[model samples]
Target: MIVSGMSGSGKSVALNTLEDLGFYCVDNLPADLLPEFVRRVMRGEDRPEKLAVGLDVRSGGDLGVIPDVLSEVGGLGLDPKLLFFDAEDDVLLRRYADTRRRHPLSHLGLALADAIALERQALKPLRQIADVVLDTSALNVHKLRRLVITEFGLGEASTLSLLFESFAYRRGVPPDADFVFDARCLPNPHWDARLRPLSGRDKDVSDYLEAQPDVVQFAGEIAQFLDTWLPRLQSDTRSYVTVAFGCTGGRHRSVYLAERLARHARERGWAEVAVHHRELD
Candidate 1:
């Protein structure tokens, strides 16, 4: 598996998490060396069963070389998977804040937000070719761990879910999402204090909000959009796709919504869906 993501979006944490879960993890590796790296592993030069590596901007102009690298390894009889973790600007900023680490581009003395935006641009190619896109803006390590376990077939939700979550800044985002979103334009759930703390999972919250014509209308629109969107993702012949949910605090509406959405998708005959509340806690 190739663990790719933005510099501050838990790429390091996920590397360690994968190792804890038994992946022979390699970090910030030279992208040009991947094909040979696998060669070494297959020859018993490294751990065999589970292997993961980190790839991102540190590779410089060679950053775009990964897809070729992965393609080269394809005929080797391994169905290699590319897993990426990406989050919104603010969430990434918060993570950087909590960790107090410097962005790889900080040497330019550029504002953190701008640096992240630029980095996203640099990583767009990989995102387009990725088998999975995890938006981690609101996902916490615990939620992320659960997602990793569930989606990867290592947790209680054994069926495995290639789950992905979309979120909004006006709304909270998920802390454990493999994918995340910034939907500030959708609507704002923060105006109402009562609904502010309640997630989409609560009956009262759903009822109160759905009672509003706008909420019902928007829900239908988003649901329809995803129905078309998700199937395209699944048809890609890739391993899996996981979609997550997010709101302003991840505590109230988004969490509740994600749970219900997961259930809805499951009932509709989508294998099994795993739900995670990234910012709920």
Candidate 2:
């Protein structure tokens, strides 16, 4: 695993999470040395089964040559997964100010903001080739760790980690979603006076939705679609796949479908199914 990102964008935290997961962790290795290091690990009998390497702007000109080096690593029969961490410039600036650490480029007489921009530009090639791009603007260390574990934890040895998140359409779909199903077409439980105060998890709301033929059919078709195609995705070497269900309010229809889908996926032998009710939270 290769983890590279903007400076102060949680690269260290991500590497630490991988370390906790039993990966052989290396930080700030020069791009030129990556293939040699992985070659050694591949040849070693006592090395950890998984490896996590952290790279950042400090590598300077070496960053530009990473793509070729990574290609060479792949040539050696290692499926190197690259994960890039990204955050908004404002958030990065705030983090630096809170920590009172000087930017790595401060010696070049560049302001912090300029240095951040330069770092992003330098890292663009790596980001474009990343297998997974995690936006850390809204995540703290703990949440980021959970996300890392959720995507790359033990269950990933066989199947993809499945996540179902319910969100309101007005709030926008999650950027990480692989498939988005709109539950707004189903009957609106919010319209009922009795169910207005209840969420999809409530028995009353579930019953109301369960009574609707269209709702049942919609959910069934979704499950069937995933049943047929998820294996295909897993075969593609994806570590994680997130399917988001969205409704107008996200409290009723979307939440109901997300929970139902998660149950169905788990029943179908998906070992790592997770559900998130965004509006409920």
Candidate 3:
């Protein structure tokens, strides 16, 4: 469990970063009120895999409640760590001003600066008790992302991170793809004048593309290649993968080929499948 600090302190960003690292997140929880919820979630269901939460003053200001929650966690035999995010009031103030937002504590008729100071004071007890404390004033987005990836071990991933991407020639490339192939060799139905505007999912288009022996062979080869190399790729612990398949247009041949490969991967019990048709719409 992570009980994050003040609003405008990048708590949400931290929480979301953890979520991407595969932590299920619960937000803005009161510290005093966490035992029952934690007990229920942890009991009768085993470890429930992994989970995280953001407990803070928006729910209640008594930091002492955290110790009780920790005690409950110890009693329940679930060790939950508390990470706190901190920043200079000036940095946080600038963040809020730059984003044109108000502090969560400001809703109580307090000035922004006053609210920040009050929140800091309220959370002081929690900070004294934190497992890892971060001063985010100097951490930009990249640094913050790295911190979450490093400290919580959330960013640790297997070597073979399979990325299935779909792209349009006009929109640039998929941001997270490991391997890319150009399916442009398959006959493009787009230039047929009649089929030019249709997508691969259309019955006529699917039939036409499926009729091409070359296209079937190409897809089969690609799938077979991935199967052989992916295991070794995993052994190396590669962080991300991107595969791009291009054609004259992204709609017909490339989409058909991509989907076919995806189906093959799924049938083989490979669930790390993500497919996008960059221009198929």
Candidate 4:
């Protein structure tokens, strides 16, 4: 696999995850050297079955040659899949500010935003040919790592992975969510002093929410909708789907719905159900 992406878009994290999954990983290799490197690996007496290479604007050489190099590698009996990671411009800008890292193109006398724009334009061809283009604007490092593992390291490549996430509407809906459900209409556990400090994972909170008729009906309807549509989505060859639930505080209601839906998905024999509470995790 070839990993290429904008800087600060989690290429390092993806490479680390791939390494943990037993891939021999190399980072920032020049695009021009890829073909020769593959040839050397093929000639080695003990070649690794899995390999991952990272490339980006930092990789010196003509980026335009990448496509031909990939084709050349394929001709040598190696199937290379390109994975491009991206984020919204604002997200990338914020990431750069948070990390206090210089952009690779900053030395060329370009401002941070200009450097990012330049990198994006330079990487356009590679993105166009990418087998998968992941927008990481809404994903934390953990979520991105989980996504990589689900898509690549899972034993069965064909099985679809489902992620159920809960967030506060105040923080905004997750940009990557396939479906977003508002849970603000449900009972507010925050009003009850006893359950105020507890999250939806707590027995008291769960029992409280489960006791409400409106909550039960809402959950049931969401479950039925998923049951009716998820298989059709899977049949369409989607590798992953994210379902998000949002409420006012993101503590009780949203988390409970996410957890409940994950359990429901698992009970229905979906092998890859993961639950994440944004506020909690």
Per-model tally of clashing residue pairs: 38, 0, 11, 0
Looking at candidate 4, the ten consecutive residues that score lowest on lDDT are 150-159
Quote model 1's TM-score.
0.55
**Candidate 2 segments whose C-alpha is farther than 4 A from its true place:** 155-281
Compose the digit string of candidate 2's lDDT tens values, residues 1-281: 99999887888877866775678999988889899999898889796788999877887666878889989999998889999999999999987875568888888899999999988998998999899999999975545656788776543455577778888999788777899999888899999999999999999999999999999999999999999999999999886788999999889999999999999998999866667676664
Query: Against the hidden reference, what TM-scores do the models get?
Result: 0.55, 0.55, 0.56, 0.56
Alpha-carbon RMSD, candidate 1: 12.3
User: What are the per-residue Cα lDDT tens digits for candidate 3 across 18-44?
Assistant: 665567789977777678777777666
lDDT of 2 at 148: 80
- Tens-place lDDT per residue, model 1, 183-249, is 3334555677876665666777777766766666655665677677777765664334555655555
Compared with the true structure, all predictions reach lDDT values of 0.68, 0.85, 0.71, 0.89
Clashing pairs in 4: none
Regions of candidate 1 where Cα sits further than 4 Å from its true position: 45-47, 158-281
Candidate 4 residue lDDT tens string, 165-206: 999889789888999999999899999999999999999999
Maximum-lDDT candidate: 4
lDDT of 3: 0.71
State how far residue 127 of model 2 sits from its true place (Å).
0.8
